[model samples]
Target: MGRKVTVRDKILETAATLFYNQGYVQTGINQIVAEADIAIGSLYKHFKSKNDLLYSYLEQEDIRFFTTVEEKLAQKKTPREKLMAYIDFRIDQQKTGNCTGCHFIKINAEIGRTDDEVQQLVQKHKEKQKNLIKKLVTEIQPSKNNFDAKQLTEMIFTMIEGGVVAATINGNTRSLEDIKKLADKLI
Candidate 1:
């Protein structure tokens, strides 16, 4: 038999589900404890505060998001294919996730300004994503007459971000599909 899940795992798992489905500010510790079926003391034992739980959640999400993206990207043979795969992955996620916006983006909008730690975590995650795109851009278009790899990366990244936001607003994946088409043209 496998090891049983700990109370801390239960709390974290419940928080992740709640935070993803509901807004972070809207998800209370009591709700997490109630859904997790754990004592209030158990949550405090694992996390000092709600912010602490959020921090842990963000860390966990970062690991999971990047790991999944890297795995998907690894399956593609070419840089353009990898980039397209990234866009398609996001589109599929949006469709399956009920059009919920980016997790980090949502959390950042909630507490990015007030919380330095959360802000840093969000910034670092975005920077890493941009760097990955930059690396791919370098591979796809080594030298353009007027545009550098960094500039192209920013444009592509912006398009992807805009696509996600648009898709969320429009309640469809057309924006994401359009962005992919634009990216195809650019590449």
Candidate 2:
């Protein structure tokens, strides 16, 4: 049997979908309350404000994203393979059609700058992602090539992020595929 969904889960789920499909600024608390089938007082009780809900959403997404990525990485034995798995993971996400590119990036573009808390959350997410890549890169066996680990990490991070943005804008995974190919050659 499935676990029962709580009112807070309903609110977050509804808000996440709306915030992803529609802009955060365009989505309102009343809309969330209506869609979530919860009372305004309940939402307020769970989340102090819209910004509070946004933070909660981001935190939830961060956990979900990293957990999935860790599972994906676990399938591969080598650091290089893990890196490729990460790219493949991103590709699969783009193919799913549910992805609004990178949620952190989208949120940042939306109101990250205006909202200091949101901005910090987004920055923290990106830093966590970069650090993951750095960990994998550091695990890679040293090769005869002259590549710097730091530079390689930055390059891979940029390519992956840039590819996601391109794929999102073009509504296709060609950019990600191309990046995967280029990254495979580099690493």
Candidate 3:
């Protein structure tokens, strides 16, 4: 017989969906176990508390974002092309029926109550996004204000994040189209 997966894993998966769809505070541990069809004790066995589960969710999401970016980047021919693919990928995510708001934004709002691990994870993820934009900017604009590429990369990041927020709020995709246009101007 195949080995059964642990109940803790099941609870975390259910908890992640709940936390993602419903806000973190709005989703309770009881709700997670009930939805997971597992005993309440199962979660505590794996995670020290709800905070542990929340941190794990944030980590998983950060991994998902970069992993998707890498997979998409590999198919393109140049850094510039890969960068366009990055914007198109965001467009695809905006079109996804499940996208609420960017998970990082939501998680950022909750960091006041979160542990250092998750807060650090958020900080690290933000740095990665900035760096990715910096790499793309390097390919297009070799000359810049500083070695860090902060100003230009940050401008692009704002446009990208703004598109996600607008899409979530209005439930319309015009913002993504606008972003693509703006990116064309940037490049």
Candidate 4:
């Protein structure tokens, strides 16, 4: 017989889905327990509180996002190709996921100000993303005369974030496509 899924795993999985689909604040422990088909005691045993659960969820999201991106980027040869691949990946994510507008962005907007841990997590994620872009930009432009990798990294990051917000609002990939075109020009 197959091993049964742990209650903790079930709660985390259910919370991830609900938190991603429904907003974080909109999802409650009771709802997670009900959806996960686990007892409240089981949830409390795994996570002391909702904040702890959120932390775990954020960690899971970070790992999943970076792992997926690294795997996709590994397929590209040149830095330019890698950069473009990132843009394409973001666009595809929005298209495939029905344009949820970025889990980090949504969570940050919801709890960043009030929750220091969540805010830090969001900041770290953004910094990592910017660093990746900076590495690629350096390879492509190499900080030559009048070319600033840091500035370009920030610009590209902002464009991508804006594109995601626009896509979510417009319910189409036009914004992401526009960003990709702009990135192509910049790169």
Candidate 5:
């Protein structure tokens, strides 16, 4: 039998959908309460404020993103293969339109700098991603190394993020494909 969803789950699900699809500032607490089918007091019980909810949503995304990445990377044996797998996973996500671009970026663009907590969460999420990529870069063989690991990490990270932004704006994955090629050349 399936487990029942908690009031917290309902609130988070509703808020995540609304925040990602609609801008964070545009999605009101009332809408989340109504869509979640929960009482106003219930939301407050789980989250102190809308900002608190946004932080929870971002934290959730961070965990989900890395879990998926770990699963994808595990399928590959070598570090190079693992890095390529990550890029390919990103490309597939964009191609399938399974996501509406990166939620972290979308939320950050909406209100990251204004909210110190959100800003820190975004920074932490990005740093975690960069560090993971850097680890993969450092593990690759010397023959494949075209640039220093640090430089390569920055390039690959920038390419992945820039490609996502371009693909999101153009409604196509061409930029992502190009990014994959460029990354393939560098590493």
Candidate 6:
């Protein structure tokens, strides 16, 4: 029998978990290959380089993370509920041990805005999320007051990033709860 065709995706999945949990700088291709139980050539076959694998991993995280969220958020009837659902989902995710500060932001810092495909993917993911926050804010409040909407959205996203980092580093889930309260106030 020949090797399974799922090797590439399996490798990418392992790479994403490792790269995000441990900084990209701290993860090496050899480690990914070991964790993935795939040959070195298998990784190289799918991605041209470690950067390419990291780029693909970030994109996958974006798709999986937001798709899961938008799916859950859709179940809520009101935008207000949906917005709160987003915060609640983050807290719930922390409880499940999936917490790692925003993967894009963490990778972006580790990579330091390098002119590489991975960094570009990271920027795109962040911009997409920021835009989503803006959209959700507009939907929830339908504000004629542009300043309030803008400030609230910015503060909420900021608090979210802070909460994620705190949860991952200190295991302090109170930050997530505190941020949700602050988000309610800002909104």
Output the number of the TM-score-best candidate.
2
Instruction: Output the worst ten-in-a-row residue range by lDDT, candidate 4.
Output: 142-151
Candidate 6 vs. true structure, TM-score = 0.86
Candidate 2 accuracy as TM-score: 0.95
Tens-digit lDDT string for candidate 3 (1-187):
9878668667767877788788888998888878998777777878888888888888878888999999999999877788778888887887884447777777777665346776788788888987998898877773424434456678778888888888888886788788878766666
Supply every candidate's count of residue pairs whose N, Cα or C atoms clash at under 3 angstroms. Answer: 0, 0, 0, 0, 0, 0
Global lDDT scores for all candidate models:
0.89, 0.87, 0.79, 0.89, 0.88, 0.81
What TM-score number comes out for model 4? Answer: 0.93
What residue pairs clash in candidate 3, if any at all?
A: none
Q: Which wins on lDDT, candidate 5 or candidate 6?
A: 5
Compose the digit string of candidate 5's lDDT tens values, residues 112-149: 58889988999999999899889998898435655788
> Candidate 4: where are CA atoms >4 Å away?
1-5, 142-145
Candidate 5 lDDT score at position 111: 88
When 2 and 5 are scored with TM-score, the better candidate is 2
Q: Deviation in angstroms for 40 in model 5?
A: 1.2
lDDT of 1 by residue, 89-137 (tens): 8899899887888889889877768999999999998898899899898
lDDT of 3: 0.79
- Write down the TM-score of every candidate: 0.94, 0.95, 0.86, 0.93, 0.94, 0.86
Q: In model 3, what lDDT does residue 65 have?
A: 92
